[model samples]
Target: MSDQRESIRSNAKYLRNVRPIDPEEICEYVAGNPHPAVVRQQLREEAADLRLIEQDDGTFVPADDEPVSPRRGPVERFPAEYERRLEDLLVERYGPNWEDGASGDLLRSTVRRFKADYLDGRPVEYNDDVAAGYAIYHLPGYYAAIQYALDDLADRGLLDRTLRVLDLGAGVGGPALGLCDYLPDDALLEYHAVEPSAAADVLKDLLAETGRNTHPTIHRTTAEAFDPSEAVSGDGSSDGFDPTAPDDGFDLVLACNVLSELDDPVDVMQSYLETLAPKGTFLAMAPADKNTSVQLREVERELEEERLWDRDAVDFETSAAGDAERYRRGEVTVYGPTVRLWPGETPSDRGWSFDVRPDLDVPAVQRRLDENAPDDGEHAPGEFVNVDVQFSYSQLRLDGRRRIDMALETNEWAKMAEMERHVTERIDLVAAKLSRSLSGGDGNGGRGSGRSNPLFKISDGSEDTDHYAVVTTETALNRPLLEAGYGDVCSFEGILALWNDDEEAYNLVVDEETIVDRIT
Candidate 1:
């Protein structure tokens, strides 16, 4: 069997650059004349290793070398195919009309119980009912949120075409499915998911809907227990694997919505960073709520600019030499969404920042579940709908790449660290717009008036306190603050910086005199 597999691989390698390698045609050349179906299955297993893409005609072709391009527009809706797939899974487990009866009661109570636990900062176990409930309530928003977070990497051509990815605590395949969809059709993906729950079942079913070139493996284990070196190694063992090898690491490591659930998030994050390729990215995300978002930033700051050591290289007996050797390993840096624009400064503010995108169109399953809620004095109109796309994400890299890398000159722009001195004075400043409009009819706190001023959270990575940019008057010159997307850096000229005693933050007032331009 091994000899036949090797013979098939040899033939495909020779024909890959020449033309599409058909499994049936290659089967004729194998030692024992294995069946074409067996050859096809063998090729599917080796596609990632051989860098081949399986086609619809049961043939294999070389994957394109170009990186996946950044998606240009907002993720308006979750794909219908995945929606139907989830419904199918629900039907298989619970009967048809799963939205009502005993199944409905179980799912509704499961969602409410977990939601309450999350609000109170308690961990919720991922049993079968909880997994299905999570899928119906959280899948659409999470699926939409990840693509937006990935744009911070894809925009700079950082995402690769031939990709190896590790997804830690990949609950119910929200981020996994989002990433598969984010890549172009020609891109080849080797996805390894670390999830130890019933959610893995749902994830496995949903991943089947991904493109043919995407090869997925679900490791039914926790993030801490899963060995990264063994997973990425060729022979599935870590005995002779080199942790420092360039090609033996994942191109992207995702820890979305999982850090807040870990006991030691910083140490776990550092461990994963050592397994990242030279130019790979580690994207950590959390819910937009205050506690989780703040905790995510806390983990990011704890690991930022800190050198990580190869655990095997450390000789505990020789402390001095070990410390000196470990210092040369690597440093973790924040890549984007949040900026470290100033050369020698880091924000010490509350760091409660989040991005709000256009709400996703509600999925059919969510609507069905919500509409069928029993009127036992507990059901709200839209209790089960999870369409809001609000999330907080931090992109970390060991390659020292930042989405916005620019030095702010003190003579030209006012540093956020020195905002106190410039308060009550019209000043020029540069900042990344971190949040969407926080005023008007939006649920976010602000005036309830229909004609309220547009307010945005802005950061320049040098503040010890929170800062906001308020557009009091709209004009052609200052309208960019309202038009620019989240994480966009805008230049504010002749803007009045005032201290808001009520909010305990600086509000940069942009009126007719202010010229706000988005720096591309």
Candidate 2:
């Protein structure tokens, strides 16, 4: 485990030169402590050089040498002052934890990590937050439900063997891949995914590497715009699709974790459901809330009208608060969130209460906070202070090995941009040291010297793997092997390793292990 940790750190150091400059870094490089006059001159030069290409292709390509390209989007060329204001706002909210101490290296490292795992490639989390989310969220069960639903449809021959499937809101393409794995080879399983996040890039990489039948046309675009009808003539190869023709649609349509964002989910479903062939099965997973209930009701109404409504209970509720209170009162923490414990195969037996806050909007909450600002740590009358957090819980159940892969999505790029400064600084410092070392002095000196590597670099970089430590006479699982600041990777093998290894010899620390083999 120590060797593996060292290896990851060494690799990080070696790849310092290969790190890409983040948008924030590019801004900083040009803004470089300039006087008012120099700043004006630079801004003038930038404006004089601006050029936009109006190409037939939808892509807005910028001039290659332009420092401030408008093609990436207006946000891409934000002024230095704007960035400063944004940083100040982040500091106010997240405190000093905002930028990892103003070093762009942290942001660069984050980007590099994202690129390495989820960006330009399939997110192969050896162990990380991406995986942990899957573990905690019980994503595997959702995949299982998809498979089961599809199998039920397939068994009845509802979808012909040649049917192609499109998975919407596929977080890491779990359901699409799982369905493919479960179906027979001759099923003609064509998989298409609709994801909106910049992580769509990651999904594409995964699709390419996994040897799956993926149509680039089937990626990145939203379902709203993915229709064949909307496709323009001469817009790339129809790629087995007719631009003017209605789709044969899909055999199975999987929509998970997507409907909640819509104000009119019913309309969205109605629009997309048309893409499914007649007698086609649509498996939808919502947050299991009132909003979800409304959407389900819409689906139910539509189904009943078509006489295809078949429902089953896939989840139950267990109150984490209720369980915590019981534990605090000197009772066993039972009847809490329906999580499977250790080798236990059953979910918790408890009813759950749903708390819906449709009235609370982000802007409204921010405004309220500003209006009722705490004066010297004292709350004003009628001030909105959250003494306790309110959370809604729903227990989802299914059967299968969970596929967990977590990578920082595109929305987090700005946050990661802040961390990039730290990473760049550290890299500069390391390079300086190396330069000095090669020169005359103590064999270590370059530009910025004597700085420690980022916390993540020091830690093992396995996001989809597990790390174990020896405890007493047994190897115990380090519940969360990685720190919160770092990435997390959880797996079934980690669970089994903890269960079987009550031994002392192999108690040191284990990074990764296969649990199925050990358990079986």
Candidate 3:
């Protein structure tokens, strides 16, 4: 190992140009079964701070994009202190009338009502006093969701410029606050916020918390009612309705957590997309509920047909499958014209549950709980309810759209899948049943007759990867094929319908019956 290290010490110059070093592929230069120590030694010799980052899949990859220093963990921290101050102000606002001690139960109930109103897409007529309290309760979770969304945007090269942001229905400016935290110290940002709620009253105060880092302008109007032509374009000056005018549109448009509440959300989204400056992004996010997520998907679908934007979902899905399924790859600007849940975020049986910390301090609630104290003295008041949040988000843009006259060539799999889904045309792809080992079912291509839904993996003719899909068929549909088919499993080679899946693999349905010639 030492000899190899000495031999490759000259190679350190080449390694310096490679920022992120994949730990897996680091051994090509060394001779005959080089021990892992030699690789480590070479990496250290090249760059001392280079570290192996464990990905979500538990594999180590070089942290090339922006490597963290040493073992200090993620550079981003939740803005807990900034948020805590706002909660303190909420309690202070009600302190004057609390001499007799507040009702912890009432405040808790009010907070719960605030949350329910948000998810149910209903008006929050809970009064100004409770509105402030609700912000105190929900801001952390809102910040978390917006932070994750903005983090994703930042990673996609969308935030590379000095950001000019327009946040619609900006709830107390949470997305603006999250954006402020995401940018660099010297990175200038101009933020414009549109919100008609009483929550808008405090958005300036919250933006001020960023302390000299951001410039915020609050537009006090409902999104649908807000007119972009009349909007001040953040340059401290007014401009007429010229699209080519300076300071015309936003680089980042945020319709965060408020899409479902708008009167005409699709129309509002169309308006928002128009206000996007060239090379701009529009993001729409909602609570991680089934309805809101589904609505966002519908919005994504509608946007594809709109003339303003070229869709990115197809390229997004194709790249995810990488080059092996490059045949399935679509143009970077084209999409399925359909919006599905982002991968791994499919609503589970328990529904859209996101992580939250009920552990944050709630002094007023605590006082009320303390006053109403039981003799047993266990459990925090807010802990018994849902306080944390998860959400679904859709990020789209207008920069990549193919012009109206241009033709869109569909990929083979997408075409075949579409044929199966719509035309009811049968197509052939090599498919294997999803082994029942994961779901505790017998892998006999089981459906009904005391079996789980039939799931399968279709090969893409790629050795290292396979596409997993599921098809819904009754025992009757697959039974005939099986009689001609299996020694142990039902393997089919032709005429299957494309069903839903994680995009890497899918669920495909077989025809009612087939002659068994393609079985393996």
Candidate 4:
């Protein structure tokens, strides 16, 4: 398991580099400090230098240099001063937890309730007090999630079309800050923010006081209350901003952490889409909480069912010009409890959450913790804070501009895997039965979810055939086999590996922290 973990990390490091990415993909070749200024310079230079040609379909493909440029990652972070300002706000709220127990507890409780309300899909009515508390306690995370969301788009070249934008529920300017961090230093950008919370004011001031290079118009309005028809276009022309007037429109609309709180997400989403320009973009992001995760899936389904959107996954591979993996990707990373513990074959019950490790100002955070601790303490915030931060984000190009490669119709058989992997990519697979006699224990593979069974075989096809396949121990695919009274087919998807046992025989294995269903 330790060996496999290392392998996965190495693959991730490779993806940070070698993936053939577009020159406009923000910070695609950056690594190390992940400073915004350095990233900004690289983004501009690469875009200008890209010799890629445009296909008749209007999509730009790698010409000669391979749009897939090398990038060093650990994703770009918000500007350092932003973190300083965040820490200062936290310090002021409670004098750096000067009151100790009271302030910390209050902030924690507010965050919990905020998450719960978000999952419950309420009207998102947070007064100034709760909103402020949320900003102070959770802004760092929001900033992290927003950065990841942008990184995903940037990796896919989704940010190039962006110019005029609207940020729904733009709390403390997390997404706005992310945009400024990636867009070229001199890029002409017009931003409009719509939020009900007075925190909108904080977001406006954060952009101004913290020195956001871009100009943004912050509107204190709810997602439902805000009207795109009243929005002003990027150019001085009034028509582009007003969807009703319809000359041109904003390039991107980002609704981060707002959907889970919306009263009517479907209607709200449609309205947001209505505000886009011809080739505009829309992104929705939420925390890794189970219910919010569920909400994002529901929204994805609704978009497709209505035929208003075509879904696509991120691509990671090397290709030039018009050639890239239709959905270039490699394997999946497993997490959480191992073993098949569920009585019913249900992966959703395991509860997957967003895992992110944002580059936080640890010293500043530790200093705050130290101020609350007894004088005799030597604290290591890095120990506790390096843990993965997770969030779910979904993006869509407008109906008219949607990519043809993205399936117009959804695959019914893969629905379970799709919902389970709402945030991450998984290699689709179907579990083929091995001789039952080879199995020793009842559903308990004994090994954790990461352990795959040697006896069970894996195949990618619908029919049971060993024409071309690998053996897997992935308990995620095994649960369905465990549940059925008698069946030969189950589903599985995860990071794939080929290992040689003591005898030196190669065996294929897929890790399982997740449980998948077998409709067959």
Candidate 5:
């Protein structure tokens, strides 16, 4: 068996660049003439190691080396293939009419219970039923949100063609599937997911439907217990493993919607950041709710600018002899959505920032569940439809690459930190539009009315307190504040800065006198 495997690998290495390496042909070349099915299984297992992309016709070819082009527009809908796949899983668990029977009631209650637990800041365990319910309730929105967050990296050409990604606490594979579709077909991906729950079973089933170039492995262990060295080395032993070495660490580490669930999120995040490749990105995402969004920023702030050292490279006993400095790994820096536009400034406010994109077209399963829901007091019309894409994400990179890498010149615009002195006075300011119009949005937690002035959260990355831009009287010139997309930087001319005593936030009033222009 060992000789057959080695002979197959040898033939593949020689034939990969020359032509399509067929498993049938390789089987004939093996010492004992192993079955073609066995050869195919072996090829699938070794695809990532060999950098081979399995073709639709069961042949293998070399992966393209070009970086994936960034997607230009919004994700309109979840793919029908994934929707069907999730439905299939639901059917396998609970018969074909899953949305109408007792199974439907079970799933509906499971979703409501978990949602309530999340809102109340309680730990909800992921059992089989809970995992299925989570897929039905949260999958579509999470799928759309991740793609939007990933745009912040892809727009800057930071995403690579050949990628090694580590997804921590990857539940039911929403972000995983989104990422798979986000990359171009020619790009190769080696994905490792750490999920220690029944969700791993669901994740494995969904990942099987991904593109041929995507090779995934699910480590059935907790994030804290899963050692990245095992994935990097392909073995449990980490002898002489250097995480900082090129081609050894993950290119992207994702902790989406999982940090707020951890006991010590900051420490765990710091440990994961150490496993990032020199030019890697660590993206953390959370729900748009105030508590979770603020907690995400708090984690980002705690790890920002802190230099991490490669523990394996540093000799702790010889640390007194300058060993630590010699083994310095990388410094963490915020890479996007949020900004640190000023050179020496960082925002110290309660950073409750999030981006809201167009809601996705509801998936079939969600629609089915919602349409057939019981006519009970608890069921609302749109209760099961999870298509709103509102999320807070922080991209931390070791390479010091920012999505918006402009240093604001104080001579041209007023700093948000100094807004106190300019209160009630018209001033020129440059800031990123962090949120959509809060005028009639649900972002105000039912406090805002539809007829109120157009309000948005804006940040220049130097404010010590929350700063908002309120469009009091929208004219042709000041309409850009309302027109700009989330995270877009805009320059405001002659905007009045006022302290809103009721909201306890600084409101830069944009009126007829204010001229707003989106700075690309």
Candidate 6:
């Protein structure tokens, strides 16, 4: 092993610069290997200073002397059934005093905001392509674990029959809608989405327009304050909740990308896990971020005490590199895009495939060339490649029209276009070898050229290297590809497009393991 270390380091570039990793490929990697030493090291480094904050709800908040402002709102005036449950939640959490006029007005306003922003007609500014794209782009890889775990449950006949699904912190309803798209039409799914933001309204309207509202129940309630009873009427049935069917506890509970936000995710999960029926599936997904790691650890700890269902590691889905970076930076303002779960075994199900158009998915690869290089304005210190996941493969024939329509309604397309351009410009750099080869000029200047490949250089704030990386003799190549497939696969051709093709420079690497470790 020691002998192989030198080779691993020497040939790391060659080994790392592999093609895009598939969902199945990642599944196989986890299936084959246990946690690696580096992973443990990274986890420790990432978690070293971690201190568990004993939140009122039992979820650990990061140690911050600055108090987390209490979430304030009026008592919601949902339909009678939803109202009753909302009242019960108010009493249980905030004490009975929270059920009156001012509180009701506050809740009403918040719900109205949720309906307006996320329902069908309201509006808020969450439609930024960079934000949405970042979320959509990376969610699949992490979603893949949920898919695999759900499939395993289905294979076990656990998800058979019409199942009720509840998506907590359902951001733009990505996983909720993604699951809706993934499930069979006749699957008899009663989707009850709990999103407290205006974005929830946008998602609600989206589902309704797409005819997915046939059996949907949307509540503009935060996960902490969201009342399941509100989703299920007093008589244990769904009312104006779109589906308007019986509102028993959900058969499958999906909390994706939101756990990291809770003061006590376990308390939140515990609050809902009991709502699941025997043999029910509880799935949670989160970015393979520090918050997720802590949340998962906490959940595992809690489950150990409960002696509930077993857990199996699964594949890592894909999403935007920038989004993942935001998560690492704890800058992702929303959740639900990443997922975490309980009760569900490692899912083996192949979730929905991306259906973005080919042209849209395949962006032009650009290399920011150094003017003084062998080839003026030709050689770059680095390369930037973008793959439009939505455009990559539309085999599923998804009507991005609805999403696009929503995008247009939100008017985020222009912003998305601008973001794409901005990202491209940011990642464009001088490829060390390309600059050297360019200094040799055209094909006429062969080897033995005096020019040298540039080493690491800082990126202008304009680009988000959240996706790109530096390659050197000891640089690991596959890391990026791992990231790409996990979110957006950067093709070899895309790399070549940015290369000078002169010097022996390191190509991109897709480290599926590392990528999976981040968002799953």
Provide the TM-score for each candidate, comma-separated: 0.94, 0.32, 0.55, 0.54, 0.92, 0.35
Residue-level lDDT tens digits of model 3 in 29-102: 65554665555544433331122332333223333443111111222334665655565555566663331245
On a 0 to 1 TM-score scale, where does candidate 2 land against the true structure?
A: 0.32
Cα lDDT, all candidates:
0.87, 0.32, 0.49, 0.48, 0.85, 0.35
lDDT of 1 by residue, 134-190 (tens): 999998889989999998888898998999899999999999999999998878999
lDDT of 5 by residue, 1-520 (tens): 3667768888999999799999889888888888998888888767777777777798988877766677888899988888889999999999999998799998888989999999999998999999999988888888889998888777777888788899999999999999999998777898999999999988998998998788888899988898886674222234455655655778899999999889999999998998898788999999999999999999998899588864445434445565444565656889888888888899999888888888899888998888899897878898988898989999998777788889989899999999999998999999999887777765453225774887888999999988988888889998888889888899999999899787787989898899999995
**How many clashing pairs per prediction, in order?**
0, 42, 9, 21, 0, 86
Q: Rank order by TM-score, top first?
A: 1, 5, 3, 4, 6, 2
The model with the greatest TM-score is: 1
What stretches of model 4 exceed 4 Å from their correct place? 1-71, 76-78, 87-125, 209-213, 233-240, 244-247, 307-388, 399-520
Which digits, one per residue and each the tens of the lDDT, describe model 6 over residues 446-511?
A: 223443331221111122121123322222432332232212212221221122234332223212
Q: For candidate 6, what's the RMSD?
A: 27.4
By summed lDDT, the worst window of 10 consecutive residues in model 2 runs over 427-436
Q: Name the better of 4 and 5 by lDDT.
A: 5
- Better-scoring candidate (TM-score), 3 or 5: 5
Q: What's model 1's lDDT at 109?
A: 90
**Model 3, stretches more than 4 Å misplaced?**
1-77, 96-100, 103-105, 116-121, 229-235, 239-247, 309-389, 401-520
What's the lDDT of the predicted structure labeled candidate 1? 0.87
RMSD of each: 3.1, 26.4, 17.7, 17.4, 2.9, 27.4
Best by lDDT: 1
Q: For model 3, which pairs clash? A: 310-401, 467-505, 468-505, 468-506, 469-506, 469-507, 470-506, 470-507, 470-508
Ranking by lDDT: 1, 5, 3, 4, 6, 2
